[model samples]
Target: MSSPPNMSTTTTLQASPTGIRMITPKSTEEDTRLNQVIAQVVSFIQTNLCEVDKLTLNTGLDIEDSPRLIRVLDAYGVRYFYHGSILVIMGACPLNSVINTLVLNILDQRSTILPHELCPYFSSYRAGILCSGTIKGKGVRPQLRIKIPDDSITFHHPGKHTIYDTIMIEVAFSESRGDLHREMLQYFEHYRPAQLAILVKIEEDLSSRTPRTDPGFRDRAAQLLLRFGNDLGKEIHATYLENSAHDTSVRPEPFTDDEILEQIQVEDWIGTIAADVEVWDLMHSEPRLRGSRTRLFPTPDRNSVPYIYAGDMIPLALHDSFPNLNVSQRLAIDTDLLCMRMAALIPRFACWRAINFFSPEDEDEDMDYNADDDEGEE
Candidate 1:
């Protein structure tokens, strides 16, 4: 009863699934245009660029010369590419302002780029912790040159663990971590060292925010510290420390080592990890009545607080070095939370405040807080 299909219906029938969608071939004209663009970009990079060992701006290019380069790339709508150690230009993407700024800085002979803008893929550094022995082993050369594939600088180390140690340092700078698991596996399988100590460093860009006064930034940084170190494993050991230097621009106070202990200890370890905590703005220049209780000095049976000191008030009780009470009776505060508080205050106070506890301890004490330095006899 069905009539034969009309000629128009036959022409409208759907093609095979593969042919109907997803694999449509490019037109001959479109293919030709793309090939031409690729050829032009390759030629431009070859003729106009110089190959360098690293991504730094010491590439002999200057401010006057950068605009011309930008124009050349703009003509082809070029963005960026990574080849060897240098970031190369290939094509343009509208969302590449960060890369564009880096290129401008490189041309202008600037010393550094914004840390957030840096792409780990372009640099040879991979992301992870790296450790090397401090002492040299027997029969191994007492000194040897250490070279990193990603870095041009040649470091002189006391031991010959450069191959293994260098890998650790290289991976530390990397932001892309998809390939890290494979690289880590390779390292463990090859060297088979008895123990590996992972060094984790949390660096905050203090020029941007006030983590001390603002709770949001402080809380976020604290969270990152936990994610970076705490979530890594159970075998990890953590410590908190602070290094302060005077910013004559804001505070006239000179840097002083006010504590017997080098590293600043966290106030309450359990409380810091479990609940939200805020540090007193001890260093904030804006005058305000000191708080009732500080991390270093807790109120004892609700005692009356002393009047604010006239000069730069170094609240001795706030520093972890002076713990008047037993820690077991007090709450536990995470090291990361302490670090976050310290980092946030640096920018707000315009001081050279560094939260450093990751480095190895020196055997000899260079300076003592209580002892006065001895001047040479006249």
Candidate 2:
């Protein structure tokens, strides 16, 4: 593969089993090639390139201009954060996306979580996604590291204008799992006030969640191929628990998290704070997860995902003020009929994932980028 004279970065055609040949990232290490690709990616993101061929790219960038770069990516919903002088982007947030969508949609359908102080709790119209915002705090090493998580649960400082993310969630796949532990530890140790850090490794490729299932038994898959259009006048009866984890079609391979589950001994991780830490795999009837050594869920059922009490989750600073909210029943993410509703939310999320998957691709065709466009607007 040779780079164009003016462009140092070269792209390769990734031919898929589906016979879909699309452009994906090739090593863009050489600075000359990177400058061009960065320009192109930024240009595409800044201007919604409509009629262009599909190009899935993953490349590194040198941040010479911080403000301008932040504006461009933030507008396009690209995940990025600062690490000292470095700008890190956890691109293609595969598994983290699942819970992000789950929690937000769960809040949307029914009920909310935590303190009532965070007015308009869970609102794009209010706080983008119930505790709307990214995690920002002090002592981020190098004093400039900013971690923009795949999704986060934030809350306002009871009586202050500031918002803080109590639950910092991030997901990584096998390829990117090496740095997962270190990054989280940094967040916990260096970044003060880091309450809970969830690092999940997504072993399966979630480029297309709906299509990631095994072909042999896809019929039994949780979110099968079904055109979910707004009702013209037809009834779409939806049942939550109908799609069991035991369904042969679910292709447990995707949840290749067994090894990860076993290794993340919650005790070693946060056992001291470990008044209680629940770990459970949904695939089986009983939970194989336990704290490094401690009590289990109060009265857990099969449907329960790993849950922690408000007592543990709430910052110790605010514990005494809101004693009533400390119980598990009130603050568990799945407490408010969250399980059934999360299942129903799968269809809507399928559409969202499909759109998000394709939208980030660079438009390889001829397109004009307007640098003057929206540069001065608030």
**Top-scoring candidate (TM-score):** 2
- How far out, in Å, is residue 96 in model 1? 21
Residue 15, candidate 2: C-alpha displacement in angstroms: 47
Q: List the residue pairs that clash in candidate 2.
A: 8-33, 9-33, 122-130, 267-292
Instruction: List the candidate 2 regions with Cα displacement exceeding 4 Å.
Output: 1-77, 81-85, 93-96, 105-144, 174-178, 205-304, 327-366, 370-378
lDDT of 2 at 5: 53
lDDT of 1 by residue, 98-149 (tens): 2222222222321122122211211222222232322233221111111121
Lowest lDDT 10-residue stretch of candidate 2: 267-276
Q: Give per-candidate clash totals.
A: 19, 4
lDDT for each candidate structure: 0.25, 0.38
